[model samples]
Target: MKMIKTAFCLGLVWGASAYADPELHFVDLQEFNAALDAIEAGESPLSAMESYVAQASPVFQAYAQRYETSAASIADAYSERPGYYRSLPELEGYIRLREPEIVSALSRLEAMAPAGEVVPTYFMVADQRAGGTPVLAAGAAGPQINIAVAVDMIALTAETDMSEFPGGTGGRAEASDLPQVVIHENAHVLQLAAQGGLEAYRSIYSPEGGNMLAVAVREGCAEYLTYLASGWRLGDRHVYGEANERALWSEFEAVMDAPPFSVPGWFSGRHPDHADWPAQIGYWMGFRICEYHHQSAADSDAAVRDLFTLYRPDDLRPLAEAYGASLSAN
Candidate 1:
């Protein structure tokens, strides 16, 4: 108890000390209002963060265990704080207080992280709130996240809480489809870190739109990475009832050749022929891209080093261009 309290106090002190200005890390209260206004105006703040905290709970615990408090300890310490009660603050201030430490840790991780290796493993959660903000844990959420318990959420409706989906299939995300969202958000973190240039996004999309290929690479990479990282291919579910690998592979091959746009479990966009498996296409293509690059590397570490280089759109255009590997082919 004493040690936990000490660490808790230290965290607060660190936050207070680092910020001679109490307003450190403060979101322009206006920005949040602007986000709500935009949402009201039909805009999405999916990526526009009110604020960013590098240390997700897992990152915080890893960091604290090595240096301060473990995640369990921090959670324990929160028992003493008022805002963390049953009716915790909607934005959760303690979660905010620890943000600096989390960011610092993530930065340090970026330096030591091996390329092509999954993000540091501490940054993922299977089920987060729907319509909630995306969180970063390790390596820009890397290209994939650990997915569990979530794929089944959209299938069940009678039960509630962790045991079942509250609103049922009508609520949010089908079991086979949840991974797309998981992969898409992680891809954003990866892409943003790999090469900050988004002028292309502006060129491809209107103020109201976003580029399809860019979105594909991001989403596809997430999908690919999720499988590479966990071996669960949501797309595989497409042929779940089939017993033969030959038949399954054949069906999958067809889906690949088919434009993925609006395929229920893959992608959403139609203009670019987005797939319900938008993320899967990324997985399908992005994995090949990463694998090709990873194998080309002189060493495993080089994989991470070269991740940024792989961000170029030219690498993906071939997938849609002549002589490009057809989406259906392995």
Candidate 2:
């Protein structure tokens, strides 16, 4: 229950006096870890899971209800994964080791956040498959964020031990990057708030709608904002390097104006081998567009504010084209 006040500063997008720092509620990872320990010591894993669910924060409870499943089912599924439960102690240790770093990172992010009405609740869980990865993290306007710590630590360790997962890009392995991931997801929370709250944000950006522009705007701006807030890139190595980034932008420009689903294939985790592009290149593309918009704007702060508040995809075309022109000129 550590409460870090929002460090108010002048020149913020929402003004210095606008929003107070939201209370960050860290879940009791120790209790959860002990539950896992009990499971390892021969207690019924499901029973342990049920106890956890009973005591979880409202955000986690909502997450469970959203999937139309009980928390026990979700916990059971995670336990079913090979080496999942066994990894809990190691994961807890990793989190404890990095607690200071995580807090510091969050402080940096909060410093750059706009004043808003919603204060988000933050927590950690043990689901590897919760979002897209075992260490999946997600954020929304309720300002709720959940990180699956154990799975993420395992993945991080695996990546460190091995160069990269088979058919996976092996970048972003350092445990130091964990805070940046949290910042990226927090950026989503801010974005959702900017775009008329959670339901509206989901309607336009959810995968079911397949709105490429929206997805690009949503995710790209999030990644870009994370950089602005934390000075770190969300993904692997290639994106931060100038040469590879320029090439990827050039390719993305060709289809930047394509219809919603026209170039959807390009956004997949599996990128084309011939291009030597990193997976999820769409994130990079959107980031570049937002970057150009920010750099080219008359008021940079306003440009960033618009990134979160603006919902139209077509409005971003000029920004993308401007960036493309600069790339070609170079």
Candidate 3:
């Protein structure tokens, strides 16, 4: 959660007062496309990839500085998955085609955002765990919070071949799904901003401390807010969770408070204890908690805001318990 400084293409500093509205950046994707073109022209993969990193946008440069590995590692990854890399031209084209729609969807979020809050989002090509992530990029002025979307990854669909890729494509998203993914990640940044900043948010909600509930609620709130912002549900997990709510709840209630690493299935992307369950069903459980809290609150708007403001795992305990109690009553 500590701020990670990055060297951006533009020397402009990060200051909120300078911006009237949230900014969207696509320079990273363009740079990645240029790198691909360089690689196609017989340039060394490492050289092209390093150049891409060097020329990436501020948020994406921060993403690389924090989440990515060496240029050699990325070159190796590219070499290993030639098919994935080969498809990039088409993927990038598809993403560009959908840019207008994505921009419109992102516009909808500004109205939904907290007053005067600027959550800049960047579309980039990078190796990342998820399609989108909250990142911190700092220049001389100070650290600025941003949402970085892995446009290349999000452009993948279920049919996308990722077998040769180092990390199996667990969360593949279609180009059309970009809006919801960006919105969900944007909400995550707001959640951090709500509790001071990333480091502050991390202090209270950490999986290492066995506060899995907090982590769940954090993700759940994002998903729920994503739904509120855009009519789409976050993922198929919600559909599955709704279909088997009673059973899923029973299982989740047991380990919702457990040390998540020991379980390795709830949010770890590993298969759950029950063979039939999808990985990361914990998101569904957390969504239910937040959804129920919002529904039962006298002021739904306040409850929604509280999702960002409330800081403690214990703050969500009552909601979880109340939801569980209601489940039992039924």
Candidate 4:
């Protein structure tokens, strides 16, 4: 039996009584890497991939099924995109090199999260199509987080010159920053759990009930909480610099009350013209709202806890308004 190593961070030592460390399971990495190696060796990846999926925890399997297409399709995609397979070794090396820092970051995030809010089962797998941003899917049945890392995307971004890569600007992300990416996704897991699981979360999107504010609130909270957990500000990420954020916020506040459905392009990054706009400006707006709520609260910890529980646009709107007011006052 292969030894599955659990990553652990040594907590603060206070005269010999150290706090309990957070544990993350990376068994999937070992299994998934083996599958990638098989593909590189001119072998069919289906057998190894299926074996891995079969052995995964039920929650993890469900998440994989929910977020990914059929395994056969995934295999075909990898086969067609040989570059994705070629990048596996480098991606694996990156993960291995940063294991210690990644584990420590996870520990710190777990410690910062509210009690009983942590997702225990975490699976990391390879998905050639994910680009640099990892896809996180929370299981509806249990505390599980399934993450798919895009090797080719990461490798392409690592290149100094990205002129040849599609969506190069959007996909650019440092391999060293994977820890913060994981933390950001984990923050979403916490948010999903707080919303009474995935079913309730899906319920909010019903035609009459759905609104752009919901999208902003949901993504914004995750973005803000990610910063709280890892100290990596979303505003500082990607092409969005300080000036970009200020401009976006100014525009967002001007027309925030307009129905989210009316201006779908503004709330979501679907419009082609939005290429010049900061990527996911909605996330930035949402984070500002959460930041305001956090700063206004008498109890910061309690405020964070409540922020995670907010799933309705009505609840989020007031905080956003308050944030806008604060900006005006400043």
Candidate 5:
């Protein structure tokens, strides 16, 4: 149950009685270290790992429920890539080194987010096979959304081949992208909080008549905010989208309301039309939509809040169209 807690006074600007103190839990590293030690000692890691999960901090336990954190799943993952598992301890060291900066980055959220919102952040070395990032889970204590980061995956070297991974090259990032991913995902947590709650936010992504534009704009908003906060972009999508804006928007508009996996796979992995293009180009379009809308809004704070508050296609279509119209004008 070891975790670090910090509370920041966001002042009285956002019109709140109080703001929830954000907590960062590094208990996952403790669990991994204990389990790794047992493995090296020629002892079973299952017992230690299980005990750790049972006694884990509330945040880590919530993350465990979403992903396969069982010893068997982890052992299987280790069996596949023993070298990767071994690298985690060293990565744990890396996370510790960057912890201060990570906390500082997360602290910036106070101004952007609604007051009294609690975002519990967790850093963990978990099973990479589960594909952990932007990790948000619902718990009994309101929306228990924790940003569960896979330290191992983020620590992967750029030179390492990711072609065999789930999203291939399209759905991955290197160690350097860690700060941006954390901030981007943190923005998502606040966005979900603003858009009702986790369940409400989840409803928008339903495959049944789900609007890809909504998903795109939602992610785009986060991407845009991440850039504003951390000055980092998600892969090369922003650059690629900027260079080929007109053509991409032309293709994107037709399928923006289609299911997320409809055609070009804009938000999903692998763009079918262009093999060389980066993955999730929908993110770029979404980013642009939010950027244009935010820039045009008279009230900056209200404009930023609107990005997360209205996630439906009906609400966001106007913004997208306005951006599209502006594109034509340009």
Candidate 6:
């Protein structure tokens, strides 16, 4: 697909980590955009990643620099770069969104944050962790599983939308979906704190680890928090955690039957919502456990704080004790 360049200058850069990475800095819009254009033209997300590593973490720079311009352009061209939509735009935009409506909605939710809730540190590409900015991979939340703390809110989208008009719906995806994507990726930021992310992921999984369950928990928490942040507007992933129960479960019978692709997981199956099938399931279902745990906790803020410690459904069984429920079946 052909990509076009757009004109723009710096407006803002954001992240998930509590403390910004010292190494994740960039030279503002001009230099960053030029570098990013080069990346979208032919650079691999991995190779292009290093150029972005710094106080601002390439993850943030990745989105800030090219996502809107490049990803949208490539998608506009309807190219075959399968990941062109997701890599360049989808994930990053979901994390550091620029849409006006979403921000306005967030402004109205401040009154809901429990005063005592220990707002988990917003996390992002860690300075110590290399291999580019591990935005979605590190994970974060209002609680601790890896490490407990109250997460004020996580941005998650209940998006199950997709298209192939040009750059695939993954880029200019949709508003409802951005929150979940944002929260899930940020959860990875939280993970970096407890396990050094890459190293911990390796230890939990296999030689090719990238622990899918951990990824799900990180993602799930983000989804759950997005709902908490949005006052449950994002929808419940747990109610349909079981594939058989989801509205599209029958259409996607084989979804979530395996782990995520470490090399670069991509699901191409087309359900009613494009390729949003199994991928959406992971984020939603995984989060349900956390949601249940959160609802059951006497002190909701404490539940948020305990979220980081959770890495799986089993981990949640004990956590949900306060709710007198067992998530072992999940």
The all-Cα superposition gives candidate 3 an RMSD in Å to the true structure of 4.1
lDDT ranking of the models: 3, 5, 4, 2, 6, 1
TM-score for candidate 1, please give it.
0.35
1-330: candidate 6 lDDT, tens digit per residue: 001111211221123343332121223222334435656699754444344333333334443343332333323332333332233223334434433443433432222322211112122221111111122212243212111111111211343222323444332223344343333333444443333233333232332333444444555665566566554333343454454444433322233323543422222223344444433454554565567777767897677766654555345435424322343243
Winning model by TM-score: 3
TM-score of 3: 0.84
lDDT of 2 at 137: 22
Model 5 per-residue lDDT tens digits across residues 1-330: 101111111121121222255556677777777777777888665665565566566555555665646666666666666666666656556656776776676777646776325365677765563333444344454334456776655666754544334445336556766667777777876675676553333445656634788778878888888777667785666778889999988988887887755666676556656876676788788899999999998998998888767766688889999999999998
Residue 294 error for model 3, in Å? 0.9
Error of 1 at 13 (Å): 21
lDDT score, candidate 5, position 91: 59
Question: How do the predictions measure up, each by TM-score?
Answer: 0.35, 0.69, 0.84, 0.70, 0.79, 0.43
Computed on alpha carbons, the lDDT of every model, listed in order, comes to: 0.32, 0.53, 0.67, 0.54, 0.65, 0.36
Residue 151, candidate 2: Cα error in Å is 5.2
- Candidate 5, which ten residues in sequence have the lowest lDDT sum? 1-10
Q: Model 6, residue 27: what's the lDDT?
A: 31
The digit string of per-residue lDDT tens for model 3 on 1-330 reads 122232322333334674545566667767777888899899998999899877777777667766754467667767776666656545546656755655565556545655325466778765544567767676446666677777656666665675774565565656667767767776766665566554443443335543777767877777787777667665577778989988877777776776544566666657545756665677778888889998999997788777776657667789889888888988
Model 4 weakest lDDT span, ten residues long: 1-10
Tally clashes: model 4: 0
Give the candidate number with the greatest lDDT: 3
